[model samples]
Target: MQFNVHIGAGAVLASALAAVGVWHAYSSGWLTPAKPRAGLAINERPPEFIPTNGGVLTIAWVKAYETFEKRSPSELELKVPLGTVKVPLPFGETVSEVRTAAKYQYQVRLQKRWPIQCGDTQCVVRTGPVELAEPVAIYHGETERKTRSGWARFDKAANLEQLNRSLGLALVVRGNEPRNRDVGMREGRVEIEKFVREWMAKEAHGARRIVVLYPGEQMVDGRPVPAH
Candidate 1:
């Protein structure tokens, strides 16, 4: 009995060591880059969602860059709206309202975060660098601000201005695409709702996200959920 107990303990200890070894291997990214990695392929594409009543919502991603490198998001560019809307971000509110091409509506601002650790997982995610997506845009204004940078004057005046804040026209959203009298647009509404749910699950509080609602593409006079 004593001998058997000793053997069992030894086996269990060995198994645990093996398991820990495997976990560390995974988390530390020891088994990656089996193939030569030239570099990470960085792609930034906006995800679009179509809803009922001939409307579409596009979730464009914005990335922070050297003040000049990425001035505004190209994917979802917004022309200056006629009026600037000042919606409130009530204390402890995940959703807020702003002027659309039309009126006021609620949009949930969410943030996603990933710990930058070793180089392997870093390479995969940084390839796309999703966590940094935001409302990036270039806007036209009255004048440019001149500032000294590394012994040089730079022209910098690109931001969406609100009552007290400088906000960018971050996202482009439209209603259903023009209905082709030929091909019927499929109902992808259920799929879209699922996506938002998943994004919410991953997004934490106080994180801001941009949503654009499209209203007029499918219908003759579709009213879009304007993202101001």
Candidate 2:
């Protein structure tokens, strides 16, 4: 009978020790329930979606004008008994005027990615740069050309041909001027904002505000700060 009583006491004591150990572990967090991994919970939110349609986006178009001119000097002169007389020469001047409509494209290339930051209510997208598309479309029907010839000048045709040949390059240079680029960037900003808003409506359903930053812009205090 004593042996059985001792055995019962031993079993009770073992149970009490096990209970105390478990309580200690729980208090120390070792026995607490594990935390769910990131993005694995029952209510996990989806990632923010940004659309990059495999290539560049045409954001805006700017109109520009360029004029090319060339002049050849008259070499013929008449010498009289009293003095020398100057005569009008042919083909003395040529002018070629060109008007162009240039397209500006925006792209987020792999080398320089546009960074996008998003919150529960707003999203900010930073753009890389705005560039003029190649082969500026010239308004051929609106182009004007003029040629003048002096009675003594013989290079009128050559001068006009040269001016015409250089028109394409001149227009390209004019289209890329700082003034035109500034206009394009301003217009592009509006288009980009609109695009982002539309994208948010479809992809990031809860975002309410969209801010777009140009190459030299920044966000400060939830407002856009223009570059100096």
Candidate 3:
């Protein structure tokens, strides 16, 4: 009987010790479920969304073909007090012509300050002046030259050579002219509008309708018009 009682007491003591150990572990947090790692939690917050504003935009080279022609004087003239006297030259007149293809680049300075107005679903953005991104590029490989010399001309070859040498420089000068720049800008206007529309759609703060205006243009009757 005593042996059985002792056995029962031993079992009771063992159960109590195990219960105490379990309580201690619970209090120490060793038995609690592990906390999620820093970024591995199922309920982690996401980053905030931000929209992008456009930067500088550039158009690739636009191709243009032009013909330049020059005619040299047939005779030398001597200036006098009252009038000029013409003296026939040994070499007659030389007419030289060159046909060349040039490439021009256009750019929009979006990074600069530009006016912007927004309505409920529409936005109007005034862009900077459309400008040349680089000097005109002439394709020499495609240059075509024609020279015609009069019957007595001896320097036809030399005249043609001089024209050829100055062709590139002359074309560059012509391309920089105001009228030529206007033509180039007009040529690229459609593409520039399309590009701006697409870009504004992405960056104009949920604007569904985008209107772009270049320099020297104004909003007229809800449309764009060239400023006088």
Q: What TM-score would candidate 2 get against the native?
A: 0.62
lDDT of 1 by residue, 96-152 (tens): 122322111212222243221122111111111112123423333322333222112
Would you estimate the TM-scores of all the predictions?
0.15, 0.62, 0.56
In model 3, the runs with Cα more than 4 Å from the true position are 1-56, 76-90, 112-115, 173-183, 193-204
Best by TM-score: 2
Model 3 Cα lDDT, one tens digit per residue, 1-228? 355534588898999999999999999988997777631224544322223355656644566788888788767533434446544335457898889888766776654334455555555666667777555677889979888887666677788888877866776777667667777666566665576566566764564565567777876766678878
lDDT digits (tens) for residues 72-159 of candidate 2: 5555445434446645324333333333343433333322233456666667677666667776676667677777666555566777
- lDDT for model 1, on a 0 to 1 scale? 0.29
Order candidates by lDDT, high to low: 3, 2, 1
Rank the models by TM-score, top first: 2, 3, 1
Error of 3 at 68 (Å): 0.9
Candidate 1 similarity to native, TM-score: 0.15
Deviation (Å) of 213 in candidate 1: 7.8
Worst 10 residues of 2 by lDDT: 104-113
